[model samples]
Target: MARELTTLVTGGKFYEGPRWHDGQWWVSDFYRRSVFTVTTDGVETHQFDVDEQPSGMGWLPDGSLVVVSMKDRHLVRRAPDGTVGHYADLSSVAGGHVNDMVVDDRGRVYVGNFGFDLMGGAPMGPADLARVDPDGTITVVAEGLHFPNGSVITPDGSTLIVAETTGAGFVAFTITDDGSLVDRRVWASMGDVPDTTDVMEALGSGLPAPDGCTLDAEGHIWFADAVGARVARVAPGGEIVESVPMPDGLGAFACQLGGEDGRTLLICAAPDFFEHSRSVADEAVLLTMQVDVPHAGRP
Candidate 1:
């Protein structure tokens, strides 16, 4: 069945990193070079800007905001008083341009990367998951991931599940006390990993192509399918319990389950994604739908 979607915001160059916090939906407009918060009724207030373009967003235990500066490979920090500064320099450790991230209660951040020159259409390669300490130290948590994109942490902060786009599965890892990721295993395998270096070829090879994800109270994960144009509710071990197709066949890039009751699923949709085209167009939108289960775990 088609899930009803209500538009909360429109006219974006390209929307990514849909997050819910403090009674509003926060998202990054990749081409607009800015982040904004929107209420359920479509009211929007601009937050801050990132010249290099922003992708992922998370908050620290102190309530300060962290934004990913994709092109420059840096993490930008915004304090409660609205001051923005450099949080961490990831260029040296990140395998490629940084993408999405999830921060634990202790301010330990686990970040993903493109692993290749995605916008330039460079040959696809594996990437690394980096852990940025609260004190600004960088460490490679895991290496050789096939384009690790969206990620989430268990409620206890002991386990992490990351969506590997090219790998066609969700990868799991053990989070150590020192913030290192170990015990690498496949949480869910949708299909065999393709050997092609081309992104399109890998995505078209009958795989899930999972991207941004959110965890629910039942421990099921709702992940956006970048190539399938839908949001899939996946149980552990590769079971796709449900899939909510995007309205008008739009592509669902990222989703967050947040609201007063933590059941509102906000989805970021676009006609398509290509840095060159999205940078010059405004076809992205924010859509919302209520779900049965409330959200659980860290984003």
Candidate 2:
């Protein structure tokens, strides 16, 4: 069945890292360099700001907010009291800009990065997934990922799955007791990996480039198909069970399953993803659609 989408909010530069927490929809605006929360009825509020670009977000057990500072490669923490500080730095470990992350129940954050200078037109390269402990110790848990983007952990916190935007599929790993990722395997293979590392060439390959995503109760991953202009729900074996195409002229870049009943699928839609275009144009909007499966697992 086709799902109809409704506009939730507009006039944002670019939205990413969306999550449902504390009864509100929280998201990061990369070009706006700020984080905002939207109510179920579309009331938008500025939560805070990141001097550099902000991507993914998650909350700690103590109620502090952890956000990925993309440009500077740091995890910025905002305490419940509104005090902000640096939690961890990935400058020395991250190959390029740190992108998205997922925080486990123990507050261990798994983060990924771009393996090359994306905006500068450098060829794409493999990146590493790093785990940040509660004490701020950073360890490279997995390596050789092609543009690792959004990620999620199972409800039991025993497995981690990440989207390899350039690799054309999803990758999974078993999470050991100490938060180490092992048993690397392909969770879903959308298509063959592109031969070229050039961003444009890879995007033109017609493969499903999974971006920010969320897990549904039935263990299906709802991911934004970056170049497909749609958000697709895929089962574990790479079957595209369902898809929702973006409205005309808009491209889907990220999505999250959230709502009072966890049935609302929030999509981040924009005209294009070029930094020069998106950073200057406020053409991005957040759209929502109703889904049958409620959200599950750690974002």
Candidate 3:
């Protein structure tokens, strides 16, 4: 049995990027273009606007914040002076808006995107993966994906597993020293869940493809299953082991384990869509749960 986390934030249009920083979990509100910091007791210190669709966020070695603006197709770095600068332009390789991402231990950033006009009616090419090295050079790692959304790197930095949100599965790839991918294989499949289409399927029925994720000390992946409204823990063998529950019964977008103790499961959840237009219930929210396992990063 799993514990159902209560709502930490309600009536949010959309939420993504649950990251631990500055003594709080800083998250991006995708549809609202705002960033929020939530304390442990569910008190939000602030919700500041960033003026762009920020999907993912990272921290530089020097203590600056790096943000991924999807529609802008730019990697932004929030300087020590709190000014945002364009760190890299990824529009050439990314067909459309960038989505979720994972920054590896060595400072390489792997970005995923909505390649073919997923919900915006502005169709593009097949989905692709972009890699930005420490020198700010952008490289295309993989392409022809259905919908590359959430991702996480292995603890050892030798593997990066990405979620193909629309294709109904996840792909594990071998990460090269230069931040390229080879030996790509299906790490996990959605296993034919109902109400899920082949492409970026609808949510709210507990069946949409996965979106955001993080790992535990045991190397188990706790991925946000969009429509499922649950953060499912996937074992190293790629099996769904323990599922942490949600409040809205909607899409649990992305998740990460962070905090001083590194045992808190922070989740970004929102309502789902069918064909990107039809909506079920507005169950969008942010939730958290205390788990027994420590986070992979801290381990």
Candidate 4:
């Protein structure tokens, strides 16, 4: 079925980590260094600010908020009274700027990083995924990942799927009781990741850099392709069942399924990822489209 895309919010600088929780759409503006929530009609309220910039976010069973402090590579926790404090430090575990994260039902967090100075033009390298326990202990769960970005834990809490952006696939890991990731394997194969040095040449190859994603009731994942300017709904076997392209010149960086029945695909769109351009310009916008399947997984 054809879906209609609408702009739900605008005037942000590089939005990421769109999540549906407690009856609202929460997201982080990377360059703006703030996290906020928006309503279906476009009303928005500021949540909190992160000095090092904010990315992924989730809540604990006790109703506290956990947000990723990207530059500093730390998890900041927000209490019920709105006091924000350091939850866990990743500087020792993360080798570069931390990107996205997913928290399980038990408040265990899985984090990803750039592995190299991406914006500084350093050559891409392998990164490791870290697990942060609720009690603030950190462990490297998986390694040799090629730019692991958005991730999601299965509804049953037995498996974790991470988007390997530069690897052109999604990798799955078995989660154990001790919060360790094992049995690593490729869950989906999209295409070959470009090996060219030119950024545009790599992106123009049509091979997608899969970013933030959300799982649906049918166990299908809808993920944003950073370079393709589109969001694709892919089955477990890597078949793209649906692809929704953004308008001309705009790129989709992340997405989430939420709103009422959990069928709304909230997309984060922007023109570029360069820090200077995005931080100085208000080009980021939150768009929404209605899908057929409702969301059915952990945040």
Candidate 2 runs further than 4 Å off: none
Q: How many times do residue backbones clash in model 2?
A: 0
TM-score of each: 0.98, 0.99, 0.86, 0.97
Pairs of residues at least 3 apart in sequence or in different chains that clash in candidate 4? none
Q: How many clashing residue pairs appear in each of the predictions shown? A: 0, 0, 2, 0
Over 1-299, each residue of candidate 1 has an lDDT whose tens digit, in order, gives 56777888889988899898988889999999999999978898899999988999999999999999999999999999999999999998776789999999899989989999988878998898898998888888899999999999999989999999888889999988888888999999888876789988998887888889999989889999998999999999999998988877489999999999999999999988888878888889898988899999987
Candidate whose TM-score is highest: 2
- Tell me the deviation in Å of residue 228 in model 3: 1.8
Highest-scoring model, lDDT? 2
Question: What's every prediction's RMSD, in angstroms?
Answer: 1.0, 0.7, 3.6, 1.4
- In candidate 3, which residue pairs get closer than 3 Å at backbone N, Cα or C atoms, i.e. clash? 206-228, 226-251
Pick out the ten consecutive residues of candidate 1 with the lowest summed lDDT. Answer: 1-10
lDDT tens readout by residue for model 3, 72-109: 78888877887767888888888778888888877788
lDDT of 2 by residue, 1-299 (tens): 98999999999999999999989999999999999999989999998999899999999999999999999999999999999888999998899999999999999999999988999999888899999999889999999998999899989989899999998899999999999988999999988876887888998898999999999999999999999999999999799999888999999989998888999999999998889999999999999999999999987
lDDT of 1 at 52: 89
* Root-mean-square deviation of candidate 4: 1.4
| lDDT (C-alpha, whole model) for all candidates | 0.90, 0.94, 0.74, 0.89
